[model samples]
Target: MAAFDALPGAVRDGAVIVHFGSPLIEQRRLAAGEAVVPLTDRTLIEVAGEDRLTWLDSITSQSVARLRAGDSTELLVLDPQGRVEHAAAVFEDGASVWLIADEADAEKLAVWLQRMVFRSRVTVTVRSDAALAGFFAGGAAEARLTPSAPNGTPLIWRDPWHEVQPGGHQYAAVEGHPASDYAWSVAVVDDPAALTAPFAGALAAEALRIAAWRPRWSNEVDERTIPHESDWIRSAVHLSKGCYRGQETVAKVHNLGHPPRRLAALLLDGSDVVMPAQGDIVLAGDAEVGHVTSIAMHYEDGPIALAMLSRRAPVTELIVRTHEGVDIAAAQQVIVPADAGATAGVPRLTRLSRRPVAEDPRNAR
Candidate 1:
């Protein structure tokens, strides 16, 4: 921890780094694999026991019953209504399952895991001793990094957002996904001080993520958020996975219905310098269509943000209503298309047309 704080021009909020010096410079270096960011906002949990894999598979939104050691995947915990509640990166080490989630969700997810261990052999424990460091683990940088092998299996939860996993399906069908080239990953480390590379911060990490159209839980989720809305099914939710808490809604929405909302990216007009913030309203003319979930200033893309929009929202240019009651022009980039669902193509029974009878003279009198 002291090693990061001791770096030149380091700025921090509590234990997390805001930026080392320049967020843009750090972003460039981080993207090129010259830097790593200490992920203090992320926490870890260990689920130990012989029944861990099957137990997790029965409850979460991923197919993890046969998860092999050293392999990486993510899962989502959903409410009965199928709204996203918790999400985690999963890694098994033969002896136990390791879960990495945001600090905001770790404690609750740990407790829920423990409570769900009725007859199962699983025992859940939050690993206060572990932490994360994120970087683009591509090329030589992946080789130089040494991930923790505490149980004789290195724990590196690689990001699978670049492509759809085996049991997963993608609702996002862009011509060229920005995330296709994103090789972002996080390594479970014994200590943040062990790293020797130049460090970036959360700001830089987030900018690159927003530019890539990545839907991170902390920013993208609300009480009403479903896996389909933010296109989270691309990585987190398994379409054909066996029964889980919210599997019914998951199957229903995918096969017969369209997701009520979709995720979109807004490239705000940088001319006015009014940076719209999270929770600001997105307006299609005068009606509100969506609200911003995350925002960032990319090195090459200028100002950008991710928003959860109504499925019927305008596909054209919109206006961002800032917190100060100012409106700024924004160009929309669709992440999840409006027609993103009903993959089953089930035929709908058409309604019969009703004949309009002539108005009664008695009603007019």
Candidate 2:
């Protein structure tokens, strides 16, 4: 609150101030590489040991065994049934593997990683002293701000969502993915107070993410979320990685089946000037089909949202009902189509015996 109050014209969203007034202008500045955002909502966890990389490799969805120092990647911890439990942006210095995640899940994720350490040489520690900042421009701001990380490498995690990673597949079959323009990166700084420059706020960042159709663990994931449903396979989950907790469901759904739900981008009707809240019901012809997961008013796209709808939901036309019961018409842009899976195309086995035996006639008689 103190940090936000210091800003001249900030507006509060829950505990965090979402913008320093003029969110649309802030977003424009950010896209033009003229701004940076202090990511107060993120926290960092450090995993250190000779066995850190290998130990993490055995657990998470991404293949981390070969992660080189200064390289950036992300990982997802899934339940045995393949539902997303935790997500982190990962990078490593020569000594420690850093996991940056939502502040709400930082301690919980640290505790969980510690519990799984067992006899491994790995030690999990939360680095509460450190803070994270995001810049769509690059690390040029580091030249002016406080030094990042102890090693002087900035400990930056470059986003890989702009393109398909090795051993990964994209479920969104569009000719060009909107995420191609999402050039984003975050730096781990030793001091948050050193970041005194005017920075774009969370709302500005979120609008760009929504416009890109990118999936954020905080917004796009639910208790039952699998990578396929949100089209997260483009970066987070390694398709050919060795056995992990949820590999079975991940493989099964990707190779032979489709996710129960698919993500869609919705362009909302702007006549009401009302934006639907998260969990607002999404309807098709008066029947409820899904609910909005994230909503934002983009600088150029106007009001837009990302929704997870049942595979059977109609693709073209949709409607969202606001908390006031006013129905806002929406047009659906498919992110994950109904027939998104079955990529492996495993050949179906032919019937061994086409002719039926003169079945149990003797027994019937």
Q: How badly does each model clash, as a count of residue pairs?
A: 0, 0
lDDT of each: 0.87, 0.85
Screening candidate 1 with a backbone cut-off below 3 angstroms (N, C-alpha, C), the clashing residue pairs are none
Please state the error at residue 182 of candidate 1 in Å: 1.1
Candidate 2 residue runs with Cα over 4 Å from true position? 1-9, 139-143, 352-365
| Residue 122 accuracy (lDDT) in model 2 | 93
Which tens-of-lDDT digit does each residue in 1-365 have in candidate 1? 44345556668888778888889998998899888888878888999999999999999999899988888889999999999999999988889999998888999999998899999998999986676788897644456567888899988888888888887788777778898888898887765566665778899999999998888889999998889998888888888878889888899988889889999999989988778889999999999999999999898998999999999998999999999998989999988998888888667665545423335565563
lDDT of 2 by residue, 59-118 (tens): 999998988878888999999999999999999777889998887878888988999999
Model 1 ranges off by over 4 Å: 1-8, 139-144, 347-365
Query: Highest lDDT, which number?
Result: 1
C-alpha RMSD in Å of predicted model 1 compared with the true structure:
5.5
Q: What is the lDDT of candidate 1?
A: 0.87
For model 1, what is the alpha-carbon lDDT of residue 134? 88
